[model samples]
Every structure is written in structure tokens, then in C-alpha cells.
Target chain A: MTDTLLEIDNLSVDYETGRGDLQALRDITFNVNKGEIVGIVGESGCGKSTLISSILRLTAPNTRFREGEIRFKGQDLLQVSERHMRDLRGADISIVFQDPMQTHNPVLTIGQQMLDIQHRSKQSKADKRAHATKMLGAVGIPDPEARLKQYPHEFSGGMRQRIAIAMALMSEPDLLIADEPTTALDATLEVQIIERLQELQREFHCAILFISHHLGVIAELCDRVVVMYAGAVVESGDVREIFHDPKHPYTRRLIECDPGHLKERARVLPTIPGEVPDLANLPGGCIFRDRCDQALARCATEVPPLDQLKEGHHAACWLNHEEATS
Target chain B: MSLLNVVDLNTSYGAVNVLAGVSFSVEPGETYALVGESGSGKTTVIRAIAGLAPAQEGSVTFEGQEIRGAPEKVMRPLRKDMAMMFQDPVGSLSPRLTIRSLITEPYRIQGMKDRDLDTEAKRLLEMVNLPTHFADRYPYQLSGGQARRVGVARALALEPKLILADEPTAGLDVSVQGELLNLLNDLRERLGLAMVIITHNLSVVRHVADRMGILYLGRLVEEGTTETIFNEPRHPYTRCLLSANPEPDPDARLDRIALKGEPPSLLMRPSGCEFRERCPFSKEICTQTPEWEVNGGHGLRCLAPLS
Candidate 1:
């Protein structure tokens, strides 16, 4: 019996904009195993947020999608009723966003806001408060009881983010989706958050879908990684394998573009020239061909499929396909 | 002599002090990066130097001219030789103005009405790698990178010798950030422009800055060349900061020397050493302020033995 916790197959979504229909996500297929951490890495406008929204069924009003199946624990989430979905959200699956202050209500006290999340629970008020305190302490928040009375404005940015994380795990969710949770944090605070998250993930035994544009954070936290480019999953594999030996051109460029990877400062850091393609008016075939240095003549005419490069490693690129067949 | 010198700088907002006894200098053609976490007073240090934020008890000299608390008449003509690039590129640019006028507005302020504004605007646009067609477009029409480049072009409109760029690479993607840093570096080399760049990103400092100062809770705790700072950081906070920066490679062995807690609040700062509460090497003497220990021009404010 496979222990797949969440399975996303051929997920495609488009947003209706004034320019036209923007193909935000294209034929994305991946799965997260039970208690495993998966990271999605991409630049801006690469459909990372759209993919998360699709999983939560929280896409924008003008979003159009029909060719995908999002299954959580062998149950199709798309087919679930709205009421059932609402129950499953905080209890089964929870998410933490980039900005915790924006996610929280400024007018309410921290304690009141956390208790509000537990309205569906059958536990008494006292038990819920104790549970909130415990979860807050679990995230290394000091003096959780005293902090409950304080409003969001009273806490620092890092502390507010910790509160957000604690609230996300209040219901003991089986899966936590953190979208750039540490992006807004300072370097020292980022390390603190990552350490606390790793500790809590083990204590709760939950799978995590970590989404970020920072390759460094993803490399340190995620067990497996998925590289996104122009609304497609260009590469997916174990973190170690993908970092040591990235097969796709786009994934390689993304890694090379990181300043930390450089041993010494160069006159000019190598960059992946050209902006991400316009989704509403994408060119024929592969999306990355325009910026890819090793793009072959056939790359502009044929769409590459996600082919297996090694055990548990996959990349969608014509170069990888040709190398595999040769 | 240094192109810009800041000494014993202290700044405050009402009751709370933002910068305390901070000091640094920028040589001609050199990039001095002031690095710290948010609220650590990195921005305040540059703002104090630029005269936007008043220095409570210190001196800021540009080309050996005191301007920290100088009157507007004395500071106005001096401002023409200094330019500031803001953090938020979109918010900094005027939404109603065209790119052409935005670049030339500085010249208009300098009372150079005889200059051909359109040609100069196009030249500035091309210098920042923006297309000539963008000169006619409004601020809302450009991408984030384009907007930032436009910001850079506008900053260069005055052709200032010294540029104070506040988080120039903030809110930019990695690839775009690399390109922007390269442009800044190239301009510095080609034009010998001295820059005082305030940013929290250590990677950017490592790539572009010749020298750096690490700030913690409004104090300049460490100052040294970039190579020495990254290779052998003396202060405990500097060591922890470098270690905490997540390296991109998965296999890079990072020493897990994380600080115990978040920075202490400014309202109730620690009595003596501002970082004493969070420093791993805090001891009995840490209850009192430690003198700046200097050796070979590299300095640190901690009493701990160098590792």
C-alpha cells in the first residue's frame, strides 16, 4: 500500500484577464508522500500561488480549470461539498502565508482570534485555550499565556509569524502548506523559524508543501523539490539529487543564478536573461526555449513531457529526453 | 581623504533611539554596505548621512563639508551632488509623470533649464538598459525590474558622486537582482561613483561591497572588509548572521549556531551591550558596554576571544 497523502494530477488552470486567458498552470503532475516535505520553487508570475489556490479550491472568481484531480488521502477534493471542504480546511489541511500581519485581524486580541479558529471543535473553552498555549509554545513563542492577551500589533514581525504558524497547526492538521513563510523574515529569524518548523513537523508527523522563491530555504528544509517555470513543472526530484545534478536547463539556471553558489565574486553574476514569457500570449511549444542557451531546434516545435531521468527523478525538457534516448 | 565620513552618529524618533554611536566611511569608488535586520537602524544610518533624518549627536561630512544639521541653504546646493534610491521602486516614482520628465526633474531642480532634457532622459534610460520607447511610458506601464531600472536612471540624473541606495535589490527576483547588482557594480567601476548601500542581504554585500558593517539593535557591532568578515567574522552576532544565511546548495554544510531568541525590543533595550541578551558569548563584563576592539583596521565591539 502506497502512503501517498496528497496527489495532484494534470492540474491546469487559466485566469481571465483583460489581455485574454492567461494559462497560469499547465499539466502539472506530482504527489506528496505521507509525512514528507515537498517544496515548489519558481520566480514571480510562475503560477506557484495559483497551484496552491487550486489545491485549496480558492482560486479567483475568473479562474477556469477542468483538467485536473486533487486527491487528499484518496478522496477527490474537487468533488467534495463546500461545507465538507470548510471542515477539512483547518482540521485536515492548513496554510501559512508570507505576511502574518496581513493574515491576522489587527483589531482582535491573539487569544480571541485563535479561539475563533476552534469554533468547530467539540472541546471546551478552557481546553481550547490550553491547546492554543501549547501550540504557541511548540513554535518557540515565549510566555504563551501572557502573549494571548496581547494584540497582533504588540508583537514583532517574527513573533506574529510564529503565532500564524501556531494557529495553522492548532487543529493538528495532517498537512501544512507554507507559502514563503520565511521570505519576509531576517536571516537570523529565518533560521529560527526553519528550525522550529522542522521540530514541529516531526512532533506532529505531518507532510508539508513548502512554497518559496528562495532556493536556499527550500534546499535546507525540503526533502523533495519541484521546479516551476512559466506555468509548468520543469523538474522534480529528491532535493539532494536535483541540487547535485539538475537535468533541466531552467532548473540549472535557477540554481546557478543563486549568489550563494558562487565561490568568489565575479565581475558580473550570471543571470537567466529575458523575463518570464507572457502567459496570455505564450509562444508555441516549450516556454523556456527563448531563454535556454542549450535549446535545440526541435524545442520550439515540440512540448516535452515529464520523463523519468533516474529513480525518483523527473525533468520535462527536450535535452533530457534526447540524452535519455541516446 | 574619504569621500563621505560619518562619525559618532546617533538618531532618535521622539523617545526611542534608532541609531547609537554608529560610524562608517566611504572612499571614492568604494561601495560600503551597511547590513542589519529590520529596525536595526541600517536605513537610519544612511538617512542621517543624507540629511533626511537628523543626527542627534554626531557629524556627517561630504567631501569634508559638514552637513548633518546644516541649514537648508547650505544643504540644498550640497544635495545636488548626492542622490538617494529608495527601497520601494514603484512607490518612489511619481505615477502621474512620464519617464522622460521623471529623469529630468532633478536637472530642473538644479536650475539647468538650458540642457536638452529629452536627449538626456534617453541617455539615462539607455544607461540603465531600458528601451528608448519606455521614456514615454508612465510608471504603471513598466515591470518591477523596469521600474527599478527607471529608479536607478532617475537617481543618476544628477550625476552625483555619492549614491545612497536603500535596499536596492529588495522585492526583486533573484535573476533580476543579479542583473541590477551587476549594473550598479559596472557603474561604480566605470564612473568611480562611491555608494553607501543599506541592505539586509549579506549575499548582496558579499558580491558588491568592498567593506561592510554589521548592525545589531542600532549599534555598529562589527566592521571589516567583506572577505575578512565572511571568512572570519569576530563578533558573535556577525558569526551567527553569516551562519544563519541559508546557502543555496543543499549540500553546503551550515554551522547551526542560531541565536536563542528574537532581538530585544527597542523600547526596553538591554542595559549595556545591546546584543548581550542574544549573544552566545555574553558574560559578566557584558553588563557594561564593550569598547571597540580594533586590529589591523578590522573592528568588533564584543569582548569574546576571536575564533
Candidate 2:
């Protein structure tokens, strides 16, 4: 059996704004193995979040699909009906957002929120309660019996994050997408939460599509990585290769951007020195041409295809780093 | 002499106690960072020291003056000697004002209506490594980083003896974070100003702060020289926080300290150590308020190295 759990092929999304139709993602492709942790790294507004929402068909109004497909287990997800997508959400695929406040319902108790997620697919109310309690236990939450009865406000931010994680796992979904899970959390709590998440992913053998801007998180958790910029995949490789041997100019800039990484280099890393291009009026050439350090005359007119640098390592930068060698 | 001294301080918001018996000090040229998570009372300590949140108990001495409950007249003069930078740049800056006007607001407060506020504002903007032309731009037009520089320029308008920065670089990018940290350190060295930086980022302590204090809820848990705390921190909570930070080096894997339970609420504050509820090394006696052990001028609040 193919170990690949999810594959996103040339997926793109557009939204109508005051500026008109904005293509947020372009020709993005990646895959995740059944039990592997795959990270999507990008700057803000790089279409990382929009990419996840498209898979769930959860994109808000005025957001239209431009092209491409999302396949989970060789079945086309983009073609799935809205009712089918709803059924698959809590059962086969799940997602956790950056904001705990948004993920949780203030009016409902944590048990109610979690139990309710799976009740439509499940039978027996008391049986659902037992599963919720077991899930709370699995997430390393304290006082599972009592906590299930209390409202979301009664819990601390860290506790609420645990509840959100437990809620996502309640259905035993094969794939879990967590978008910047630790962004707003305290450093200590963020650590605890990531640890619990990795442990659960292992226990369930669940594939995780981990999205974060922090390379530190990717190094610690992800098995592989896909680097995004200006609504395109700039680089994709194993976590080690992407971090240590990045090929794209954007990839190098992102790695060298970290204070810890810059400590070893002699000169300070001058960040890419410009904002991400407006997707609505993208350059005819490579999207990163405006900010690329080694842009040549060809780079200003020719869009670089995703060229292979090594086995399973790909970069879209026009610079032939491989040609410089053997 | 220590530039600022806060002893047995307590401050509240309406009916809720924000800071309880918080005490710390900053030497004339040192940067003392108060490190903690949100709602851990880091900002409250800054507020209490600045007199924005008037302390209901204890004393705050700036340059040996016991000026806890000074009247508006007395405090207004002190404002020239102390300045503050808030966390959110967009909200902190007056939305309608241009960057030039925002930077010179402090000068206007000090009765400089006749002086060349525009020229002085340009100088302040240039000092923070911002372009001279940036002064003409509105706060809304500036990016997150540019707005922060404007904020810093405004904070420096008074030429204060001390600067209190609350999460100065919280929302900024990684590259921008380094520039701001270096800017704060450079400003401190060049101007010989005392600084108290309040932030949740522990990495800042190593680069900018001379001394560091870890706050849990409203109580200060661990404190010491930056080298001491980062190398041999005795508190479990401190260890957990440091480990949780994404390691700069990709090769090093952090064995995160597992804090299984939730941190206790401030309303029902713990009887002893505020961290005892979630600490990995909590003992029976940790249920009692521990004394501050001052050794070699390093302080820690714990019944640690115990019997």
C-alpha cells in the first residue's frame, strides 16, 4: 500500500476583494505519508492557511477555485460533495487553528464541543461521553471527569489548547492539520502542547500537515518540509536538507533569517529586502524575481520550473546550484 | 546606585489584584528583563514602577526618591526622566497622526510647542536607523517594523534616564527582532540609560538584559544574572520555558519539560509557589511562600537545594 496519506496537486484559490480576483496559491504540490509530519513554511499571507482551508472546502465566501485537485488516499477531495466533506471532516480529516478562542465555543462545555464533533457519525450519547473522557485522558489533561463539565472560559489558555487537541483527536482522524498551533501560546505551554501532539500522532500513526513560520518548530517536529512564498512552493525537501542545504534563494533567506542561524555566518543576513508580491499583479517571471539576490536577465522574463536538486529535493529558483557542481 | 528600586509593590485593576508584593531593581546602566508569559504580571510590574498603576502598598524609589504616591504635579516632572513603549504599535500610535507628529508628541507634552518639533523628530527617527523621510509618513502607511521605530523614536523624545519597554518586539519578524534588540542595546550603551524590558521572549535576556527575572502569575519565581539563569536555572518552570523556545540550531533537539496540568488562575492564586501546580519538581513544602535567597546578588524564590 502507498504510505502517502494526502497529496495536494497544483492547488490554487482566488478571492474577490476590492482589488478584484486574488489568486492566493499557485501551482503548489506536496504530499504527506501516513505517519509522517510534513511542515509548510512561509511568511504571512503566503497562502499557507488558504491551502489548508481549500482541502477542507472551508474557504469563506467570494473565494473561488482557480485550478487543481486535493487527493486523500487516491480519492479526489475537491470533487467531494459539501455533505460528504462535512462527514469526512471530523472522521477522516481534522484541523486546529492558531486561535484557541475561535476553535472553542464559549457557550458549550469542552465535553459538549468534543462530543458534538463526532456524534453525527456515531450512535449512543453515553458511549460518546466515554470516548470524550478517554480522549481528554490521552491529551494529558488533568481532572478529565470534572473538566468535561466546565465551560471553555473556566480553562487557562494552555488547558484550552489541550482541549482543542483532544477535540481534534476524538474522531481518530487519519490526517490532522495544525496551523501555527503555538503562535499565541506561552513558550512553556507551546512546548507542552507540541510534545503531546507529536506523541498522539505517533500513537495513532496519523499524518500531520504542520504549518508554521518558525523553522525551529519544523526542525523539531517535521519529517519533511515545503517552503512557500508569493503563493508558490519555493522549495521542498527532507527536514534536514531543507534546513541545512536549502537551494532556493528564498529558502536560504528564510534559514539565514533566524538569529541563531546567523550567528555562524560572518556578515548579518540582510533579509530579502522587500515585501511579498501582490498576488493579483504577479510578475511575468518568477514571483520572487523582485526580491531574489542572484536574479539574472533571464530571471526577469522566464518563469523557472521546479528543477530537481537532489533525490526528493526540489527548488523553483532559476539558479542552477547543481550545475555549479558535477 | 540602582537607578530604580521597587519594593513590596501591589497594584490592582478595579477589584482585581494585578501585581502582588512585586519587587525588583535596575542598576544605572543595566538592562533588567522581566520575562514571563501573558497574564504573568510582567506588564503590571512595569506599570506599577512607572506610576501608571499606582501601588497601594510599598515603595518605588527612582534615584533614591521614595515617590510611590506622588501627585500629578510631582509625577508629571518625573515623566521627563522616564518613558514607556507599549506592545501593539498600531494601537499605541495615534491613528490620525503622521509619524513625524507621533514622534514629537512627547516633546509637545514637555512644552516644546515653539521648538522645531519636525527637525527634532527627524533626528529621533534617524537615531533608530529609520530613514529621515519616514517622518512624513502616516502611522497607517508604515509597515510593522517602521511603525515600531517610530514608537521607539517617540519613547526617546524626552531623553529619559530610564526606558520601560513592554514586549517591544513581540509581533515583529525574526530578522526585525534582532535589529530591534541591537537597537535597544546600542541606545542603552550610547546614552547611558537604564532599561527594564518586559517580554515573554527568553532569548532577549541573553542578547540585551544583564539580569533576568522569571514571573509566574503575579509572583516572581526565579531571578539571576543572565549567564547564571540560562546556564543553571534552578526552577523547573524556567527550564521548561527555555526548552520550549525553538532551538536556533537545527541539530539540537530539546527534550521539553512536560508540564501536564494547567497553570493555576490568578484569582485563586496558589498558597505557596505560583508554579507549584505545574512544576515537575514540586515538593510538599512548595505549598508555602518561599523566601528570596540573595546569593552573590542573584535571587531565587524557592525552598530549593532542599533537606
Candidate 3:
């Protein structure tokens, strides 16, 4: 049986904005299984970042968790004390952000920052340095020993991202949250980073909670995919199923609209009409109904529950309902 | 004759050489894409063409007029016919300026006092499919896609014959990117405008660009029709780039060619072929710079080209 590494159940978050209560995440539910790479794909304002922040317990000051439980290793992270959360952050979970340039401390040497991450470890200083060097080398950095002494500025964008990945995986955390880690890099560099992450994941045997807006990267890297739209989980399934046979209209449109997926060059690429509804003043019915082409009349008044369409595949849409389809 | 011709263009910033003998041309209604990594000088090529970055050497002829080193007086009038859409959607626009002023500012800058700015602003917004009410909104108030629409509207304000767009779909979501691409494509067709698009996105290049040039160390490694280049790439760098693009299809074959290391710094470019350091097919001859060779409308600058 597959082991679940992390689980989020009925998670809802709201930001107390001047305009109104901005519902950032609404009943978000998903889990990262042991050693499995699961990607959370969504556009901006889809609450992907908010979800990441919530998991790290680094939400904004005006944030309120409406209702949810973030369970990790049989412990509810939401119920954990700040001291306990700090201990679990690096030791059990690690994150690699989008911009590596901003991620690193300019004044600190790479070696120093990497060593600082191991503060929880009782390992000797020499052992820590050795581990850091080895981790750097594992991520394809040349001369890791000498490189550790250098500053982040000395490295190129690709190299800095590699260093960032190395630092994140140094602790060998059970779950690695990569928030658009390759988005800032070029296509060639993106490919290199993806391959490196795949290799590192294999070596460390860590589950990856990969988050990105790029459908191509998610398709290439993740085994399963969770498609988010306007602060809600629209669909979740195997990567093949999600891309090949998407059930939700949003997921289908998102996949079809991806330029990378187009087989032939067309002058007018298909586009999903309408903007994402305002989070502060959401529509009465389904969040995505306004934009969904095949939206039904029932979608105007009632919210669709996430239903099991197939084994391990779930989609939240009125069209997926038995009676609605009939 | 081509609408815009850039021959042997060379641009340097202080001590560092960015664009080294780059050359290309765009037809009156064609779209030409410049593809490269971050430091490959794709943006710099367009910047030099637009006279924003003065090129130290080479010629840029627009509509039979030499404009490489043209003074502002000479270039100002030409700006009406050739507009630029910057990379950043919101950041490119002034935060304080209303969307109406932002898009219509071009007309004011050109000193065209005859036109009513309000009507023109509404017309521009309508063209970009943005609502008329959005004219009063600030750059910060608009979404990424909306901000991009404003950028397009601003570029189209003067009824330019040619447009230079940099990374048009860089920051948008998949669906939004498609919408922007569709809008751009529709505008290009409707106005019969030529375009020079600079971006690292291969998919965007494939969808929008009629012809494309692959830049390595500020030099064009390959130049040809998008169809020909995508189907039969001669340069090893081109092949590597295409292979590196992750296909959205999960079942697609993953025969990725991982380059050895990052691109060499511009301050100290590798001798001979600049791409040789990372190239998998580097030979003894690669130590000497390969001459740019063209065959059957396809051009390449590599001694050890893929057969």
C-alpha cells in the first residue's frame, strides 16, 4: 500500500482585505504520497502561493484559516506550536522558491547559509560542510568544495537555482515543496533543472509537491497532477489521465489552451473567455461557471462537490454529476 | 524589399559586447522571432533596432531609410511607424497614470495635438477587447492579462506599420497566454503589421513567428522559416534547444539533450564557436569561428552541423 506523506483536508483560507474577505483557498484537498511527485498546476490568483504559505505556517498577518487540517506524519500541522513547526520545517519539509536570486542571502556565503540550515542537526561542523559540498555536487555543481566558499552572486541563474535545490534537499526532507522553481530559468536551464530534480528525487526518495503554471514542466516532471482554478481544486488525477482525458471543463480548457500541446500552428489559438471572478466578491454559483464554455444552468446556483469519476481521479463539476449528464 | 533589415548589427554596453554581428530582416506582414537564453542578447537586438540601445556598428534600414545611428530627430517620426511592446506587462506601464493616458501617451509624445485623447483611448481599449470603463483604471489595478492588453493597445495607438514585442506571453497563465496570442495574431492580420518578437519560449515562437533566429552569445546560430527550422534544424544548439523544450504530452518521448553547463559569460566569451563549450558535437574545427552559411533559405553558423 502507498503511504501518504502529507494531507490537507477541507482547507479554507481568507484574507481580510480592505474591500472584503478575499477567499483565497476554498476547501482545498489533496495529498502527496511517499516518494511520488505530485504537481499543483494553476494560474496566478489561483491560491497556489497561499496554499504553500499555509503549509509552511507562514501565512500573512491578515490571513485566517477558516477550517482545515494539514496532517503530516499523523500530526495536525495546524494544531502544532510555533516551536514544533520551526523544528519540522527544515527537518521534515523544505521549500525551493521561484526566484533563486532573491532566495539566497547576498551577504552570506553559500557554505554559511547551508550550514545554518543544519542547526537542528547535532552533526559536527566538518560533517555539515562535507554534507553541503556533497549535496551541491549531487545537483551538478562543479567543484562544490570551492563553490561553497563563494557567494550566490558568483553563480549564474541556473547554478544559483541548482544551489537552491541542493540546499532544499540537504536535509533529505520527506516532502519537498518546489514552488515554480524552474519558472525563472530559460528553457535549456529549465530542462537541466527538471532532470536534476528527477535524479535527486530518485536518490533521496522524497515526495515532491511541485507547483507551477507551466503545463509542459508539470507533465514532464510529475506522476500525478492537481488542477486548481480560482482557489479551488477542479480536478486531480494521474498525469496521463489529466492531460489525455480531462473531465472538468476548466482542466480540459487549460490543457487545450497550452501552446505547448498544440500539434499544428494556428493563427487563432483557443482561449478561455472571461476573467477569474473577484475573490472578495465571488459569484453565487460555481466559481468557474462564467468562464466555462459547457457550463450548465444548474452551475448557476449550486456548487459541485468533488466526485470520484474513476479510481484515484476526482473532478468538481456539475457536468460530471450523473443526473446532470443525463 | 523587406520592411526592416538589420545587417551585421553589433551593440556593446560600456566594456561588454552584447550583440555581435546579428543580422535578419522582416517582411512587411511577417513575424520574426529572436530566440535565446537570458544573456544571449535577444532583447538587446530589438532594443538596438528601436534605437533605444545605440549600436556601435552595422546598419538598420527601415523602409529604405538608414536608421542604425539616426539621431532622435530622425528616429522620433519613425517611432510612429514602429512601436515597441515591452516584456513586463504592469511594470512597463506607469503606476500613477490612468490606462487611458497610458495608451494615449504615445500620441501626446508624438506631438499629435489634433486627436481627441479620450475617444482614442476608448477606441484603443475596444481594439484590445478591454471594456471602456477600464480606461480610468491604473496599471496596478489591472490583472496581468489586462495589463498586457493595455501594452498592446499602447503599441497600436499610432497605427504602427511594424511592432516589436518582447516576451508577449511570458508571465500569463496558459489560457490567458492563448488569449493574448490570439489577440496579437488577430491584430497582426487585421492591421497587416510586421513584427519582431523576442522571447525564449519555443512554443510561443512556433505559434506566432513566421521565421525565427536562434541566438547564441549574441550571434545568430541558425535562421530560417519556422517550419524548416523546427522540422530540420542544422545547428547543434538549435537541436539542443528544441529537444530541451518539455512537451506537454506526458507520453511524448523524452530524448532531451542536456547541455554541459551554463552559457559562458559575455565578458569572456569562449574563443571560436561560443557554443562549443556546451556543445556535444564540438570538433577540432570548432576552435575557429564558423562562417554564417545559408542554403535553401536556411542559415547556420556551425562547423560541425547536424547532417
Per-residue C-alpha lDDT of model 2 across residues B1-307, encoded as one tens digit per residue: 7789988888777666777778888888888889887788888888877777777888999988887888878777788888898888878998888888898887777886777987897789889888888877888877787788888888888888999999898767766776777677778778988889987766556667788898877767788888888788877877877777876455776676776466666677778777777778888988888887778867778875322
Tens-place lDDT digits, model 3, residues A16-133 = 9999899999999988889999999998999999999999999999999999999987789999999999998977899999998899999999999999988888999999999999
Q: Supply candidate 2's per-residue lDDT for A126.
A: 83
lDDT score at residue A95, model 2, on the 0-100 scale: 85
Cα lDDT listed for each candidate: 0.88, 0.81, 0.92
Model 3 interface RMSD over true interface Cα atoms: 0.9
Per-residue alpha-carbon lDDT of candidate 2 for residues A87-163, written as tens digits (9 for 90 to 100): 88978999888887677989988888877787675468888888888989898877788889999988778777888
Cα lDDT tens digits, model 1, A1-326, are 37999999998888999999999999999999989999999998888999898888897899998589899998888889999898888899999999876989999999999999999889999999999888888888899999899999988888889899999998889899999998887887888888888998999889999999888999999999999998999999999988999999988998898887886977898898987889999898789999999989888999988998888899999888967667
Q: Interface Cα RMSD per model, in Å?
A: 1.0, 3.7, 0.9
Residue A260 displacement (Å), model 1: 0.4
Q: How many backbone clashes does candidate 1 have?
A: 0
What's the ranking of the predictions by lDDT, best on top?
3, 1, 2
Displacement of residue A285 (Cα, Å) in model 1 is: 2.1
Error of 3 at A230 (Å): 1.0
Ranked by DockQ from best down, the candidates are 3, 1, 2
List, residue by residue over B1-307, the lDDT tens digit for candidate 1: 9999998898888878888788888999899998888789988888788788888898888999988988888877777788899888989999999999898999898889888998999899999988898889999998888899999999888778999999998767789999999999988888889999987777888999999999887888999999999999988888888888898888888877878777887778888777888888888888887888778979889866458
Q: Where is model 3 more than 4 Å wrong at Cα?
A: A323-326
